[model samples]
Every structure is written in structure tokens, then in C-alpha cells.
Target: MRTKQDWEWLAAGSEYLAAVAVRELLQEGKSMEAYEGLAFLIESMGKSKKLALRSQLIRLMSHIIKWKCQPERRSSSWAITIDSARTEIEEIQEEVPILNRDYIESVWDKCFVRALREAQMEMGKKKCQIAALDWAEVFEEEYWFEED
Candidate 1:
């Protein structure tokens, strides 16, 4: 009596419910069903991980856009955020090896557009122009507070 809702739990990040469902299937000797459920769970978790990675990328890019647009108002807090997002993105990639640079590049344009809009709204500017971001500058460049 499997329905779409059975998979919805996994998609919604309900790992406990998913585990219980799989256990029940296994106990009933429905090995094939249990294996399929596990496969779906893996795919759902990968999507979740990739979404989190995208969020971090957007946050990092938005901060970089702000940093570029308003250089005069730079703060150490912003730098820390940028660093933290970069680290988290890297960690996600490490944890999920399938999500590599190609995946990041694939979503880069969409993430940049979201980031641009977010940065513009946050800056309270009705019209703020942000040039295209360089991949190396955004991910590779080090941003730090200068010693005064």
C-alpha cells in the first residue's frame, strides 16, 4: 500500500520516518521494496545537500556583491560570513563527492541572479548595478580585515 507520501517523508527530511518505513518493509521480507526506498532516500538526501550548498553559495555571492558595491562600508562581520559560507560549501562538496565543481558551475548563474536581487534589496537601493562575478574572485579570493 505504498503511496507518494511514503517518499514525501524522505523529501521533507524526515529521516526517522524514512528509517521506520524501510525497517517495516524489510521485516515483511519486502527486500526489493526496502532497497528501492533506500535508493529514493539517497537521492532525496543528495538533493537536500545540493540545496544547502546552493544557499551557501548565494549567501557568499551576495556578500561579495555588497562588498564590491559598498566598499566604504566594509565590515569584519561580512568577511567572516563570506569565509564561513565558503567553508560550508567546501565541506558539503567533500561530504558529497558527486556534487563537484561542475554542479556548482551549473547552478552559478541562477544563484548569482538570486544573490544580486538579495544584495540589492538588502542595500535598500532601487537600482544597483553589479557586474558579473568572476568565479576565481568569488570563491578563491581571500577577504580579511586590515590591521589598523
Candidate 2:
């Protein structure tokens, strides 16, 4: 199983390589022939990052929905899952700051929908009235912790 550390290292390496590839492409006169691989590499890396974040965001949102809709069922495991997802997203943003804003904005609605569906299924409810959470609330570490 690839642990969080392994994923972090892979993300860092991908970001570093993409930056180097772009720099070299610029130095080599910016010709497509000289940098075709770079485009593919960057695009692939971006997709991978997006998918990873998307999965985590969905999981996080689902847990948050569960907590809100069924507070009696909350447990340490759910809190940990929320924290883990938040950390992964933060790490991705730190590694690839350029993609942070657009990625979150583009994927938020889709993630919310998936999360809602998941929560409904898990809770055995045909319909849930939970609203889409604010992005800021989703990412806020304080929200993931149990209120004292």
C-alpha cells in the first residue's frame, strides 16, 4: 500500500520534473518538437493530481455530511479521514500552487454531488437535505475537530 509519504514524494517529483521540463523547453527555442513530451508529462501529472484531490475531497465531504446529518454516529475514524483528506489537498496545493485555485473551483461541485450521493447510500436514505458546504469550511482544520 502506498502510504501518504510515498504519495507526497511522487507528487513532489512530478512537480519538479514538470518545472524542469518547461525551463528546458524555453531554453530550446520553445518548439513543439523539442518539448512535446513535456506537454504530455505536465498534462498527465495535472490529471493525476486532480484525480487524487478529487477523491480526497469527495471522501472528506461525505464524512462531513455524515457528521452533520447523523451526529450520533460520529467517531474517531471519521475525524481522521477528514483530517487526512485535508492534509493531502494542502500538500498538493503547496507542491503545485499554480493549479490550486482553478482545480478547487472546477471540482468542488462535482465533488459535492458525489459526496452527497455517497452519504445518502451509506446512511440508507433515499434523499438528504444537506446543503453543499462552503469551500472554506471544508478545508478548515478547526471544522474537522470535535467541538469541546
Candidate 3:
């Protein structure tokens, strides 16, 4: 069977996350590790050459800003994006099979990492080795350096 629509769902997730950001207005955000991991995940998804990921990410970022500045926007924060790609985070949350943040984040994290790793490997095979090696070297070196 064909896969269910993932991007539309992710767009919804982004919308939800953005709303959360606005509601919490997290002054001190997640660790750099988390952010980097998430960025890696996003970039990996971007490599698919699919506009859905980019469009979704852009929409999500907007919501995050809205959530960050919710105090200023108040109720209008969640309605931050109205483009064709825009979907209500609340709507997405409702469709969530599991209604927990930790579970959703875990799934997102795993999917992101796996996608990135595979994408990197594919690039290496494509003579995108220079690009792939540069990325691999930095993290691997840092980890090895710390072992000394």
C-alpha cells in the first residue's frame, strides 16, 4: 500500500510545536545538542528534494516564533500561518495516536536521525563524498578527541 501522507502530518506537527513554543515562550530553550540534532534531522529531510519538508519547516518556524512571542500576540499566536501549507497544530495533535509530547518527540528524533544518516551515506555513494566526509569528520574527531 502507498504510504500515508507524512508531510501533511508533519506540517501539522510543526504547527502544534509552534503553538507550544508560543504558549510556553521558552526563554531558555533546549540544549545546543538538541537543536543541532533537530537541525540535522531537518536538513536530512531536505535532501529528499521534496518541497514538503521545507515548506513544513518554514511553517513550523513561524509558529515557533509566534509561540515565543505569544505574550505579544495573545490569541492570535496560533493563527500565525495561513498559507496553503499551513495547517492547525491543534488539528494535528488531535490526530496523534498517542497524546504525549515525549512520545512524539522521540519518534521525530529517531526519524530525523535515521533519515540524515541514510542521506549522508547516499551522498557518499554519489561522489558527494567530499561533502559527506567533511560532516562526518567534524563530529567523529570531536568525539575521539574527547576520549583522549
Candidate 4:
């Protein structure tokens, strides 16, 4: 099985190729074309990173909501899901160091909104009033579980 590190290397290679394409276009004096390629590459990278982070965030949020709304229904599986999401998010941040606190802050609310919708759907609730948890709470390992 390909490990996470292997996937990260592939992502890095893809980014490098995009950067090289932009650089070559600039050297050819194709300023407009270069700008277009560069912009597209940058936007594509940002969106990919955001989507990855958002998915993990949603998983974490959904589990937290489930844990809170139905404390009795909590299981080791829910805890594992939360832990796995946190680990994946950390790995993503390590790979793309630019996805720092500021980037998280910019995207957190939007992700949380989507997460809430997802949690409601998954939990079969008409409404889930759980507030967005703190960043540390969501990302910290073992934050929700007494034992994992």
C-alpha cells in the first residue's frame, strides 16, 4: 500500500511541474500566458489544499457533534474517526506548511458550516445546535476521548 508520505511526494512533484511550467512561460516572454498558467496553478493548489482540509475538518466536526448530541451512542469508532481526521490534517499541514493558522482561520467558518450540515444529515437530526469548537479542540489528539 502506498503510504501517506508517498502521496505527499506525488503532490509535491505536481506542484513543482506547475511551477516549472509557469517559469518557462515567463522566460518565453509570454507574460499573459504565464500569468494565466501561474494563476491557475496557484488557484488549483489552494483549492486542493482547502478541500483536503475541509474534508478532514468535516469528519472531525461530525464526530464531535455526534459525541455531544448523543453521548450515550459514543463508541470507539467515533473516537477513531476524530483521531484519524486530526492526524490527516496534521500531515497535510506538514506537507504544505503554508496552510498555517491564518489559512485555517480564513477557511474555518466555511468548513464548519458545511460540517454542521453534514453532521445534521448524518445524525438524522433536524438541527444540531453544537457550536463550532475551538481550533485546538478540533485538531488536538484525544481532545474528545477519555480513552482511545
Q: What's the TM-score of every candidate structure?
A: 0.90, 0.71, 0.21, 0.68
* Cα lDDT computed for each candidate against the true fold: 0.87, 0.76, 0.36, 0.76
* Candidate 2: stretches off by over 4 Å: 1-34, 141-148
Q: Estimate the TM-score for candidate 4.
A: 0.68
Candidate 4 C-alpha lDDT tens digits along 1-148:
2234543443356877767766876888877766666666666687688789878887888788787788878888898898888888888899888888888888789888887888888888988778777776776636445554
Candidate number that wins on lDDT, 1 or 3: 1
lDDT of 1 by residue, 17-114 (tens): 77778899999999888887877777778878999999999999999999888888888999999999999999999999888889999999999999
Can you give the lDDT of residue 108 in candidate 3?
44
| Candidate 4 runs further than 4 Å off | 1-39, 141-148
The 10-residue segment of model 2 with minimum total lDDT is 1-10
Q: lDDT per residue, candidate 3, 1-148, as tens digits?
A: 1112433343235644433433343334544433433444454343332334333433443333333333243343244342222343334445442433444344444433444444445334332222212212211222111112
Model 4 lDDT, full chain set: 0.76
Residue 42 of model 2 has an lDDT of 62
RMSD of every candidate to native, in Å, equals 1.7, 8.3, 21.2, 8.5
Model 2 agreement with the true structure over 33-84: per-residue lDDT tens digits: 3355455556668777778888888999999998788887888788888898
Candidate 4, residue 90: lDDT? 89
18: Cα error in model 1, Å: 0.6
